[model samples]
Target: MDNTKIAVIGAGKIGGAIAIALKNNNLKVKATCRTEKRLKELKSLGLD
Candidate 1:
């Protein structure tokens, strides 16, 4: 089982940064936002 778990809500400037940083370090992360645009942006940034 994957022990790394991180939930970063509101994928804005700061939130996106945190999510990406965690993912880059080999952790599981899920970033969400209130808009489709932001969600797409987060997906493009490599978040599932």
Candidate 2:
């Protein structure tokens, strides 16, 4: 089966939850957040 790539905007609670759920299902999750700080934080958490 082909892997699915999902993009979740915003790193807030809802967005984070969706990304986590999709990842748990073996799908690729990409999260976009406003501000470089938030993006850096997400990257540090290995959620690039």
Candidate 3:
């Protein structure tokens, strides 16, 4: 567990959920989505 950094590609529903769950566990989580709308949603979920 040296690097806890996580990147969620194609962050739709499942991706977003996984990212948020990881984030909740105090891991560094980043997510990418196809649309700006979903991107903002991911950001609102406290993901980078």
Return the TM-score for each candidate structure: 0.84, 0.67, 0.88
Candidate lDDT (C-alpha), each: 0.88, 0.78, 0.86
TM-score of 3: 0.88
The C-alpha local distance difference test score for the whole of candidate 2 amounts to 0.78
Q: What's model 2's lDDT at 47? A: 77
lDDT (10s digit) by residue, model 2, range 1-48 = 357788998977688777777777778789988788877776766677
In model 3, the worst 10-residue window by lDDT is 1-10
Between candidates 2 and 3, the TM-score winner: 3
Q: Model 2 Cα displacement at 35 (Å)?
A: 4.9
Ranked candidates (TM-score, high to low): 3, 1, 2
| Candidate 1 Cα outliers beyond 4 Å, as residue runs | none
Q: Evaluated with lDDT, which candidate comes out highest?
A: 1
Superposition TM-score, candidate 1 onto the true structure: 0.84
> Which segments of model 3 are wrong by more than 4 Å?
1-3
Cα misplacement distance, residue 17 of candidate 3 (Å): 0.5
